[model samples]
Target: MVTLGLVFAGPCLVAQQAMGAGTDEVLQAQLTQIAAQHHGKVAMFAEQLNTGKTVGLDPDKPVQTASVIKLTILFEAMEQVRAGKAHWDEPIVLKPGDAVSGSGVLMFMDAPMTLTLKDALTLMVILSDNTATNLMIDRFGVDAVNQRIAWMGLKDTHLYKKIMKPATEPMPADQPKFGLGKTTPREMAKVMERIGRCELAAPGEPALPGDAAICSVALHMLRNQFYRDTIPRYLETLDSTEEGSGIASKTGSLNAVRNDVAIVAGKSGPMILSIFTYDNQDHSWTVDNEGEVTIARLAKAIVERWSPAGIDGKTLVPGLGLAPVAGGGIGASK
Candidate 1:
């Protein structure tokens, strides 16, 4: 049975004065209420773009970054192109060895296929294509990717290897292999800030030589993130029916973890948020109540608190089916 422990850590509200006076208290209170109910650790960071005010719960705590690491890959790939080390349209062939078993369309394809660098990137982000990711990792060595992270002044973020590769296969036994990359909420948000400001691949350096074109492409890819299915639907209320008002974000989930990070363009300014949850209680990916509810409840609470007016009248997203547990009831089951 899945036991639910809901805890709200409350918002850190760091650098609050810059964000204005009353906002910090409200955010902190809300986050605190949310963190009190959970059993596992939750690390999150939210930054208001205009004032650069930020808040977090264990913001610096390192967490297993699932697909979010792809953002780093995307940055490095674009930087390579900007430096004239590679071309966006350059043709590359996909071989059998590049295929990985989970989450992507390429593994289903059977023949020696080819795609341009730009197309590969599109597949990587849009579909979370593992095959394409491995290929890119091969092209740009892991060392190069980590070098960029260091240059950006992010100490807790690093890319160790490809996610699709199994740890037991051929690589050094001592090497970490559960995921391709890892990062803390604080570090991840910093990268998002850099990308938002177009300072990632600064010109005339080892990465991208002062070429704004490269930065422009990177920005476009982020803005066009393919996975829109998981963003809390309530946030959509503010969005125009034609032009959704919500932000572009990514979702990552594995056996024992689920994560969502967003760059929200709010009324004040853009905000970068990274929420990570890890549960060791149940490692099964199939249907572990403890693990699923922990993440679902947290995500729901965030959406509800962040946009309470929008969600008060609506139903929770279908799968979660989490209504408030009145009188300690289990709420509605899915």
Candidate 2:
């Protein structure tokens, strides 16, 4: 593994060297080279779900989340349902004053509209809808969300405030530094892993009878996510809308940053890729944005190296049918 210097702000974290069967010196070298060539700083972590083989670059460095933080909100919603704090069909009102600017059609919709909690969550994940996200934040307090994140054992991950709105409560000293939220590549990847594996309970707690059902709902929404310009750019072969892509992902973008976190069900096994690029020179929102392309390149390289036989879309639904590891039980694939 190569040791590269951080050219951007914040403490430098050494890139995590590849481990287990996924530990290909050539692959790690390629990843380093790709990161070095990019116009911005890059941080990523990828894990093969079945074997626990992993690879990463600056995986522990915290960075701006942009819309990627929505994943946390979605996770909290799932937990709420599991605890009977909320229900999927619960009615959620969207007042005219509630709508905020930036990504999503809900803001453009008529004022005082009523939608189900499931509808709001679907919009939040599939569209990266800022309005839907804010609605969720309002429904689920910011403090509650952070508590959920802490419960996950993530130290650096945090959701600071709602999209396009001011933080009502006092914020951390560095809240302005990381816009909507912040999280390390590894932490965000862990969140994705939990959803993929359907381990909804807190550590050591047994999963509820409906945990798999809730996870299926979340995974289905992610599988239908509309933004595929980043990680799925090159690796996807089918129309995700018509025939679901083997990948379940969420993307976040800013003028100078691009992020994507995904669970790819490959022929080899299920893998998680959490990638972030920041302080980029190319800020274009086009499909060819340098940061976007950089993420795509990185994902393509990792997926190809890890799953040479390619991915299978059929494995993504019904709890990812994830193969059991040493202690975890097997989930038969649909």
TM-score of every candidate: 0.72, 0.91
RMSD per candidate (Å) reads 10.8, 5.3
Name the TM-score of candidate 2: 0.91
Tell me the tens digit of each residue's lDDT in model 1 across 1-334. 2222233343222211223342444665566455555555566776665664555666676778888887887778866776679899998789877788777898888748998888787777757788888888878877889898887788878787876575433443424643566788878877766666566445464444455556545544554455543344334443222333335455566676767676654433455667776654456565343434454454445544454443321121111122221221112122
lDDT of 2 by residue, 238-315 (tens): 766656668889999999999999999888988899999998889888999999999999999988988998887555
lDDT of 1 at 242: 30
Tell me how far the alpha carbon of residue 51 in candidate 1 is from the true structure, in angstroms, after superposition: 2.0
Q: Which regions in candidate 2 have their CA more than 4 angstroms from the true location?
A: 1-22, 322-334
What clash count goes with each model?
22, 0
Best by lDDT: 2
Runs in model 1 deviating more than 4 A are: 1-23, 166-178, 201-213, 229-232, 237-246, 280-334
**Superposition-based RMSD of candidate 1 using all C-alpha atoms, in angstroms:** 10.8
Clashing pairs in 2: none
